[model samples]
Target: MDSTYDLMEVLNHIDPSELNYQDWINVGMALQHEGYSVDVWDRWSMNDRRYHAGDCEKKWRGFHGAGTPVTGGTIVQYARDQGWTPPYDPGTALDWNDTISTEGVVVDKNWVEGREVTEPRQWDPAKELIKYLETLFEAGENVGYVVKSWKKDEKYLPADKGAYGRTAGQLIELLTQCNGDIGGVLGDYDPEGGAWIRFNPMDGKGAKNDNVTDFKYALVESDSMEIEKQHAIIRELELPVACLVHSGGKSLHAIVRVDAVDYPEYRKRVDYLYEICKKNGLAIDTQNRNPSRLSRMPGVMRGGQKQFIVDTNIGKETWTEWKEWIESINDDLPDPESLDDVWNNLPDLAPILIDGILRQGHKMLIAGPSKAGKSFLQIEMCIAIAEGKKWLNWACSQGKVMYVNLELDRASCLHRFKDVYQALGWEPKNLKNIEIWNLRGKSRPMDKLAPMLIRRAAKKNYIAIIIDPIYKVITGDENSADQMSNFCNQFDKVCTELGVAVIYCHHHSKGSQGGKKSMDRASGSGVFARDPDALIDLIELDTTEELMKQQENKAVCDACRQYLDAHFKWEDDLSQDDLCSSFQMLNYCKEKLDKWQMEALERNIEAAKAKIKSMTAWRIEGTLREFSKFDPVNLWFDYPLHTLDQSGVLGDIQPDAEQAPWQRGSAKNKKNAKNRKIDRKTALEEAIEGSNFGEKPSVNEVAEYLGVSERTVRDRVKEHGGYTIEDGLIQKSDEKQDTGKPD
Candidate 1:
């Protein structure tokens, strides 16, 4: 066969670590072109690259020189074809034959002692966990592992539990290998969602029993909140102000905790106030920072180790109690309020607008349907946000973007990110602003995920955080509406509480069916759509016109119009005429459908009366008389029925009893009626009942008597709740069954 140039190129570019089957074929083809013969290459790797033919190691040969190709010896050649000579010495062929003969014996031995022989140990999960503990220890970081496999909210590791467990920690470490530094607790800990993470922070602090009562705030980078603007808003709202720099989050979080202890209250009260700031172009940080966890940026010191040079409020009195302080401060301020507020109120892209949004952050919602480009969009977003570019030339919010993907195994995820970074023409996957959350996710349910995600988002100070598919972290059965709603609500709560505008990637549900809107089409409920401040959906208008107009009656874009646009960005490579035809089809079909629906509605009322009448002869006549009175195609403006079917509701469906009395067929199904007979059915059942002699029959006797399969006899026996159909004897369903006859 002629060698392929493309194959050669592929072979040249092959990485041994990930050599695919096609690569092997290319290599084999190349080797063949290079004069190798008699054997095929398979099972390739650095440790075990084969130099033999299929399942016949008897004639296996080794490469004598780096430049020389290996060949299968004469024993295999003789077995395949009689006329063959060894390229090497005759002694080599003889040795090959001997080894070939012995190979069978080895295989035989293995088979004979398969169960009894010592076998190689499989992977021990317990040992895997121990090794991970060593990694932390080697890094001089102290941590602990706790198994809360039952419920998520339960404590991770009891405070008294030691530094780390060998087994459980290894599992966490293995999970880390699957995810990354966002290493999380292992097991199905949560019926809700999240994971438990173990890592001793630089401050040597661990879990504490402090209730975060007043503020349901999330930690972000120092730049998350536009401190100047938010402070001004606090003054305007006459609410409290708090900006704290701690070990908890990436940004120096400014907690605006009011009387709102829960998310709903926060949304109504605090979220409203925050939106006002955002509306006038105020930006806020929304990443997570937790003192109990390790810092995302390794060297970004906290706990007053390093001081800010500019000293905006370097050593200012920290306001732990923002409510009282803000109430006091806002009561009396200078003439035009504050310096920043005065500048912001008179805004036309003013310095105050810049000042309001100076705190940079990125929050993303990486969404797509199954096989619909979720990860592609995520990596693209990461590259763009990382590179500070617009998404497909659309304007984008600024900040380093944090990409947390739970769907991928760690190695694959990193590899994909590498490709994305390269595709974006980036030499390095790491940018100052790009953070990928690969760690701290549990394949099974875990408690650590939710808090861990928020914390990671804050720690990175990512202006935008993109969680792909959203199902990975909040993975309940997203199919259930309530589960879907709760998940949405929880995520919304987390995002809102954290002060991040999270772009949560979600799957758009299946095609519009039965006039369900996009919001209704979501796998979950209105809560999934309601939780997000804004939801952007990729429109999948049916390529075929017959499909698009299928949703003509109720507006497909209704519930979402108030929040998001029903934007259709055509993705077809088809010509303009095709596009026009498609559009026209949608419009035409919709019109046709409207007319059909109106006609159907009127016709259905009469048809229903006819059906009710048909159930009874007189009602059928009455329905026919009413229907006959109307003109066939004329408008039925004065038709009586306005509702679809009141019978479906609690309302009764009354009709002429003489014409529509409940049919005997509907009273009880025939098969069930016979089954309800209980003691008697067919002649066979009666015969079985009378034939009982307090003795069982053999399989052969029963098989002979029934003239059926032994399996059928066994089944019959089993039908009467008996096991071990000895000699194929059967048991009848009737309790009094008896087949009395000597074999």
Candidate 2:
């Protein structure tokens, strides 16, 4: 599909044996559609064993172009699927969203100067062939070579599978004994056409990919560029070449070391080898990807030119070394810069998206357990940014924001925004600045979703992108540090590409999160906590019965005052104590208002009571990278909104799991003796039932479960008359006979 690279060059990358009948025909049709000659198609077809003399010409005549004709792009895509990389101009700059692969780039073809390669002056044909064999194979490895050729339409082709089952050492010894007369050692070859030899060791039978034993060397030959230029790029790229042979034609055959262990790996390595060569201005004949594919023999003659050794062992010594060197130099990481260079003029920091909480072009994660109203909190933040109002306790910069709703349906998500707006008593003046994308059932993993999000929000000028819940879009195992790190990088990509803050919410890990640090509460790997610039964790606070009663009384008083102010002018007449008391306020309202008005006020009072019962308390803890630590923020989740608690009622409440053992004991001490005994009995029963030990629970196990000393467990057992402890185990007195008296 990339027109910069020639179609003919790509065609060589596709192996005919790999394609079915239709696909092979499609390749020919694509070439024909591109205005290429039938002879070109026929010549390439001959590489396949299925080729018939007149098959291509017959297919070519019947090919009338269709309305949507298969263009050369089809062939190009096929080649790419076969691992052909199209040459790209080094001057072209990559777009923000383009994926950059810097691997296997060893040469800057634009700057490399060609190196000259000259033929051997005193050509000893026998010695050249012997050197080629020793450089490529072990002494016992079988060699496959083709000396016999047959003329085909003015071109020489290998007549058959050629000679095989001969050891390299045997051929070397035979050539040495045959003197300068090479024809006596091996079958004779046409004087005009040079002979060819397979680069890899064969199985002593036939020459095919399956017949090759060791997948060591592959041929890199290209005729598209000047011979000297091909030679220079190959060396500059540091291809692990074993033998560099002149083909006695325009191309040079550099037997590069792939060193693959098996057939599949061999194909893979060959593809990688050819891709690097093509990118660096060498157009390789990709059909030579087969492990048993042949290259021109060094000691041979074609017409008037001599096929001799150009150079031997002229690159990196091994395939791995070459590949590592290439990738090490081609990485996109920026070079280190001296701090002294910018000491006087450092760049300004990123602008604040949420004052003291997050910066623009950064990442923030809000973590909480289920029913913590985390999603609602995120929606509130979005509205705050859009209206330039305060989010929770932090002021936000005013700008358009994108809210990605991955957890809720379109209707519910839309209504939630409206509900939150009404709950906050804020006018919807900046509704146009908030855009919601509801993907409840149509969500994809974050890796795939990031680019799509960036593309859509690019022109929207959003200062922040808020993902309501990240669980729906998480890609890999949350427990795997490496995988989760990659998953979190998607957020970084969005922030960097769109220059906006990325704010998302995740559920806290299972069990009580109050005991864990704010950074350790988020579910999965620690990377989730560390990867973000700011981590805000919300833990539920323990609300006592007395606190709930206080909240209910305040709610009722506020409702009564609102009704009296609207229907009767009682505020000026009533004392402050009377107005604040729920009972006094209700009695005053009943005396002044009519029956219908009183009934309406009673309904309002009841609704307020129900709200108090449903409200949940929470504390916000932050781990910030850019700002100093702040005190924990207390809040009340009242249905559709989270309001900061200003009354200090929640300030004294500790997270249930974070309460110290001594604090629990002091609270227990407030109960009467009778109730205290009942509590102890309940604790003993729970410890026995919960213990993993069957039937009779061990005293040590019960003590560990209750977080008490063994002596304390014995006292509790003695107080509970139904249970007895003996031999360090507790059992019901009715179930087990008392043995040698209870300990």
Candidate 3:
């Protein structure tokens, strides 16, 4: 109501021609606020602004003659309701209803009333592709069209034979007819993975021939993506697309227009776009790079879902514009020349933890047959590494270790750890660096467990994480290559991102014992062994049987020697049957030989029995057969044995083969050596701290205090440097300024 009054007052005084665009908008808003509908304003404002030049004059007039106001007929009332009335006689402006008269205006309302709007038709890809080619070449150029289609079951139907000498419109018609019956029409001459694409059409017979086309767009397939996200990416990239289709079931295919001079340029542009999409979390099917890769017809039923059109913001762009878009996004790809500086870069292998057996930023597997005491052995090794002790006879690098027991209950795992702890003479609380996580009851597969464990690993920074029995966490069939590969990649992702070593335990396959190759003995797909940086197989050995066989051979030697002496008559007890009863003499020799054989066999057996008895007294039992990636030769060591002895511990037992240097050390001796180094460092620190600065002590005094050579004391003091030697005596420096030097 207020706007109506205001608009009316303005029309009475102000000329519409005097207003700028903003003033016109203000007037329109006022009229709308006052219930002069948008339809009325639009109807009046449809043509040039000049048309409303006389409207304000017609709506209101003041003092036609002295002291008199003249108003028009009902036209004025109608116009007032519309917030403005035009300047025209009632008979001319209105029919009986006081509405605008179109009698003489010759309004063309039904020019095409019964027909469809014949402007540019909706973008039919089949037609547009032909048009693009024709434009790329010239008029009367040999522009070709190749139409391929698929049957209902996705079986390739016969392609429309090469149609030559066709205009863009004619080709479109041909494709339209094919699309009507079959699933869709493909413009690609060949729609296979490595199709040789060109602009020239080949008869289905000559499709493989190399005929180059002047222009082609790269087809990209991105599946299982959000439409909104796709739109956002397109908007961001501003790519000039030939056509885009929602090609059924979470898949979208795009034909991106590329302005490339040759095949190399085309491929480069396509690869760049693909990488960009990949970097932005778009699951682009990288295999869809060929120019002849087919795309779904825009308006067709594909598996009951429509391969409908998506508005490519720049779909109809000219070659020049498309080229600009390509060049803008195509960064220079990495080349061998660009990597020249990296040619001489040295390999920086991660730090070794147990020489060749273990290292940082890698994964290892320790597998064995059932009841080989592998779990016990692995637990012992883990405890040794965690507590800065040696494992078996091998040196261990000390750090925090986590035991993820996925195959054993908490109580059982604790019991095993307790056994190893008691054997090592360590209190439970002393295992501060070791953590056991019981994941036995939980059924979280690797897919679900990887992220959680990765987060935990990042937080804990454990030097090595031992997942006992890897099968518990693996989700799919281990025999399935696809499943296992994906699972292994996921695991690798975790280890690489976390920068921690992962050690897992696994079981040997049934009847795989005594396999010559240590890896062949592992269960599941070869990936289980192939994927790890290291593999350790703890096998059982038959040391007792072999030792007994050796003893039996020695008995045979003794028996032969005794029989030879008796038969040759070197011993007086072997009389020739008391002076030659020929049968008796033969019986006597045979009897003597038999007696010696039996007696020697018994004696040697008793000796073997005695050795077994001695071994029992020394607590030596079964032996363990060991094989690893670190060494090719198999080794056998005394089992149920303690490696913690500090002295010449290997004196009591024997090895089936020579030991490697890494496997030759005693755990306690290594520990004691490490302790001595620590003690020396500690004593030097004490001597320095206890010395009076006013009476600073010399290196000799420090050496005497720690019971070491002056050179050793001086080296130790220098290694822990925080002081200076002034006049042969060490004194703390008084420097106040921080130079940011390494100490």
**Clash number for each model:** 62, 0, 1
| Model 3 residue 353 CA deviation in Å | 1.3
Q: Tens-digit lDDT track for model 1 on 153-202?
A: 33222223223333333444555565332224343332222223333212
User: Candidate 2: global Cα-lDDT?
Assistant: 0.86
Per-residue alpha-carbon lDDT of candidate 3 for residues 8-91, written as tens digits (9 for 90 to 100): 433453333323344345455545445454444444443433444544434323212324222222223333433354443233
What value does the lDDT take at residue 292 in candidate 1? 36
Across 1-743, the per-residue lDDT of candidate 2 in tens digits comes to 43455777877887665454677789888888877888888888887766789999999999987998887767875675556666753222223334434366666665778889987889899999999999998999999999988887667778878888899999999999987878888888897877989999999978888899998988898765678888888888888889999899878899998899888888888888888886666767777777888889888899788998888897899999988887877755688999999999999999999889889999999999999999999989999999999998999999999999998899999999999999999999999999999888888888778877876787889899999889999988999999999999999889988999999999888997777899999999999999999999999997877789989989999999888778776668789898778888888887888999999999999999999999999999999999888899999999999999999999998876678988867766754665878899999999987885557889999999999998999899889888887787888878776466747
TM-score of each: 0.26, 0.73, 0.37
Task: Name the runs in model 2 displaced over 4 angstroms.
Answer: 1-128, 150-157, 173-181, 191-193, 203-211, 221-236, 245-252, 261-268, 271-287, 301-311, 429-444, 450-462, 665-743
The TM-score-based order of candidates, best leading, equals 2, 3, 1
lDDT for each candidate structure: 0.37, 0.86, 0.54
Winner by lDDT: 2
In candidate 3, what residue range of length 10 has the lowest lDDT sum?
101-110
TM-score of candidate 2 versus the correct structure, residues matched by position: 0.73
